[model samples]
Target chain A: MQKNIAQGNLIPFVSVQQMVALIDSLGVEAFMTELAGYIEEDFKQWSLFDKSPRFASHSEVGVIELMPTSNGKAFSFKYVNGHPGNTRHGLQTVTAFGVLADVDTGYPVLLSEMTLLTALRTAATSALMAKYLAPEGADTMAMIGNGSQSEFQALAFKAMLGIRSLRLYDIEPAASRKLQRNLQDRGFDIVVCDSAQAAVEGARIITTCTADKRNATILTEQMVGSGVYINAIGGDCPGKTELDPLLLHRARVFVEYEPQTRIEGEIQQLAADFPVTEMWRVISGQADGRRAQDELLVFDGVGFAVEDFSALRYVYEKLSDNQGYDKLDMIADPDDPRDLFGMYLRLAPSRKGEAA
Target chain B: MQKNIAQGNLIPFVSVQQMVALIDSLGVEAFMTELAGYIEEDFKQWSLFDKSPRFASHSEVGVIELMPTSNGKAFSFKYVNGHPGNTRHGLQTVTAFGVLADVDTGYPVLLSEMTLLTALRTAATSALMAKYLAPEGADTMAMIGNGSQSEFQALAFKAMLGIRSLRLYDIEPAASRKLQRNLQDRGFDIVVCDSAQAAVEGARIITTCTADKRNATILTEQMVGSGVYINAIGGDCPGKTELDPLLLHRARVFVEYEPQTRIEGEIQQLAADFPVTEMWRVISGQADGRRAQDELLVFDGVGFAVEDFSALRYVYEKLSDNQGYDKLDMIADPDDPRDLFGMYLRLAPSRKGEAA
Candidate 1:
């Protein structure tokens, strides 16, 4: 009876506004730090997850995708869209929302806006991977294509790895300026660089997050230095990548899920049989992470469903103390499950009164 | 500018309470009739749509599924779960929600509670198939399962095909009693029968919607009469079917989508190479329906995503006059397409004030 009462017809929904409030209340740096913990834990148990490459419906302009993964007890999926042309229309290039459901009863428990959460989780995953793949004592990061994701990446590194310096660069000068302005009071010593080459100079961690859909060389082989880690996030989806094929050939590559990364990540540029280590294997201690401090590690990140599942589980866990969500009457709950028709008929009179 | 304004970050959500209100305002019979028309229209243009077998995540207890389909202009996916044991926990055996998005933009235009809509669409689909496959002047339906979907099926037949009598039977007699009580004033002459054999004694349309996760014979070879349209609904997943294989062998089987029906519909009990007509071809006048007056016709209904798309599109159209929906701030919309961090920072202060 208690389970039934708790599992009422309502689902808890956290909107974009609530997501911003949650981050603001927790403070951005602290929130990213806590988020990295969840991502790290899920990565440690990565073998337990049911993973799949996202299902995508594509058009000339962009794609709408559903990324679903489950850890036996809980299932989560993110509905996300990406339109490079959307920027011209005053919209974010990407927007998303996600759901967490109970695997036991196959009922949804939480639904939340994931655009902001994605930024947070992507940053967290980047930093969590850096903790394993980046060279020891690497504090300065070169963030190329300083667009929407630049500040989160900056803050996540600062919180998770004590990265005290950020050198940012964007093709458009205005984007780098905006990144600097946003991270002004966030306690990072930020440097606005003239080009991607200038941004990577003297930095051990180089993050390339350009949003172009073309196969451009954001980071050529000559630009990547020995012992430096390359966090490649923009080369997601086929026909889009950041690092040069030569850089991938020279560096020891790591990935989220090899089967998916082969198709969507920067590794898409590599041969079908190209060798890559699954990051989960490293996190689970089933495989070695960095063979040497100067091994030239490449984390070809395209993002994965398990990270979203971890984020949703974290939000579901945190909702108990946060009142930033609203209850939605999303499920039809009749007193007798067999009498769904009777329930509708019973509500007819009341609806008529309201209409009148 | 108008396009940008119209494509705002808000998604319209029709909740369960609003769904019932919308149905009540329209009258259930009238609503089902209108819904059938939309389904028929979509089926006519079925060749223009992208179709795939639904993606399902299975568990010991039940399954959660994502059904996605798209036309060149619009896309839709339904998140649904089916748990036969849920009734014991006071939950509907099935609950669903769906999203419709612009194929050009990948942004969700509408989010609707699909539990009620699913029932409506499923019933409408059954009647729509019957219109093409049922024998002429068939006015009696033997509804073998009298649970959640029975009344909608009964009423759909009444409104669409002028079915004036219903021969109802269920393993649990109380379910049949509830169905009879609900249809008391719906202008149908209903008879409660003791067995599946007794129920189809004098009916032209026999619908079996029993919900069990195993192979069970709700209809045997001798029970199915000549010239009856069998709407099989319950055998919607792997290893779950209702009718005897002999009936399928003798009947001219019709299906929504051949690939999906082969795995989830009653056809799963038949041979992998069993012949089945695609229903859309018949609706479009490309195939024959009811080949002979005495020929057995089986419309193996496992449900498909296009029906949900049609239902969501219909609901999106009807929402213009109905104020029964809530606007969800489900998408992250930042002023500068590349300035997601700046947008969160801008909202940070307002959220802080609300939290305080």
Candidate 2:
């Protein structure tokens, strides 16, 4: 049982752009479809995982969190940060990286730039919920927040659910214009809306992805009609939320990991005993999904580690054939482990300079 | 305020041997003295820190963890792994790395290889504790667990406290021999003992750093004298402990952080209401250190994130003036801030296929 990272070997390190290209080459639709399958499968055997709520460190400016999860065979962890006011400083709201390792050996097999992968997985998770919760052939989606993550969600829906028409709205109209322009030749019909109300007017799915870190009610209970799937993406921290309490109460709420969702999801505003279904149950066929055509279902997305684990797995496979990764010498190897001092002297210059 | 990490455009990674060289260049004694002062300063404003117990992913072979801490001015984190069984695999039992960043900008100012730094920091912490807990003229110490970290613990005590004699013991005789051989010319009088009893005989301080992830009775209550200071290092993680519960009951235990120690330190064996003082309290003069010369003081060392934070800060200052570091485009810098997709086109072409 003496497992190891192996001698004279390197772990796969994928850059953000390399991963974006890898995922793009994999195709957003195919990736989303495959990613959903991995999430669905992991969720089915959920009892095998050792789970814990994310460990978060918050400051006045932003938050940095570490989310770790392990299935019996492998372990994964993501180091992520969210800074809502960051864009004002000319930085992205989120920046991240992660490592996946062998459960037995404790050697990182995949060290990846997860900034872009996070966007892919978040969108993938949303589309995954739509696959199980949306009505048959649901095509039109009203995207309320059109920022950096907007195009990702748009493309995921377009590729996975065959979403054809997108009615987009944002606090800044330029964001909507950018989303529309990016998908111009991609064959999806797009419409720019004046407000959130106009965006959700006749859409089958309404996605509220605003980046406000406050208790702002972007979607009222009345605004969210029946038979609509709402992907609430931006309200991920405490004191930050999107859906009105009434809307949360009315919708058939589904969550990735309940204890985490209770603290960081839209349900953070609600009572602890607030009834909600774990998404895995629905995907595993053990629980009902979209009970009625007019049932308003809320997929409260604070984002989860399992999705990132799947994303890491997805990109690891893609980097196998690509020629663009840097091999980092992260771990040390010695002929004799007990002679670390000797190893150090041989590897680095002597502690004493000159001929001493 | 939006803080950006893009302007400097340097990755600045430090390898283990490089960090050792950096510390050596700065003078080990001077570095240790400065680090101790920094640790003391941070401890004075301890309430401002957001601290938590490390998140560990454990398996039969080894354990990997993420230890994160943040003050208002800065954020720091360490990625470390321990596998006592790794000796057979030709790797050190503990391997680690970490990053220190500005709180406002969220940019990593230093990403260091802490495999050796961890050992350095741990020894520095112990030496700092010895300054407060050990009597004014402490001379000899029993160095239990003669592994990779032993020589470091030995040297730090020699450099910082002017300890003149040493006694070493390990389960593996060869390890003890290696430690003895390495420190032969290092100023301290080294003695290799056959048994733990032989090592602790007539010693002023007892340092138990055995690496078994079990409740091993490395030092029993009978083995410890009333006035002897105990530097308990290797007992970390939930079921892993070095001392017996009886020892904790008698010793005036000083922990790094109470919440974290309650889970991973010798205090884990105590009741939930167990009274233990944070080491920072003693450092800040808020709590008494060594009430009586005969009082037993235990530095229940699981290693704190804040110590790593201080260590990273010290090394960052040491290396900031140096010229050897690789600059990585780990962060996304979109010109429009709205068009992250546009940055890839501007990224550097493959340094590959270039005449290296």
**lDDT of model 1, residue A189:** 90
Candidate 2: TM of chain A? 0.92
State model 1's lDDT. 0.87
The 10 consecutive residues of candidate 2 chain B with the worst lDDT sum are: B1-10
lDDT of 1 at B53: 71
**TM-score of candidate 1 relative to the true fold:** 0.96
DockQ of 1: 0.62
Give the per-residue lDDT digits (tens) of candidate 2, residues B273-352.
Answer: 87888888888888998877888888898889999988887777665444444455555556665665444333424322
Q: What is the per-residue lDDT of model 1 for residues B1-356, given as tens digits with 9 covering 90 to 100?
A: 01222347988889988889889888888888999998999999998898977788888888899999998788999999988888787777788999888877788888889998999999999999998888999888899889999999999999999999999999999999999988888899999999999999879999999866699999999887787889999888778899999989989999999998998889998889999999999999999998788989999998899999999888887776337788898898888777888779778855444321
Residue A102 shift from truth in candidate 2, angstroms: 1.8
Question: Across the candidates, what are chain A's individual TM-scores?
Answer: 0.95, 0.92
Residue A103 in candidate 2 has what lDDT? 67
DockQ of each: 0.62, 0.36
What candidate 2 keeps of the native contacts, as a fraction, is 0.32
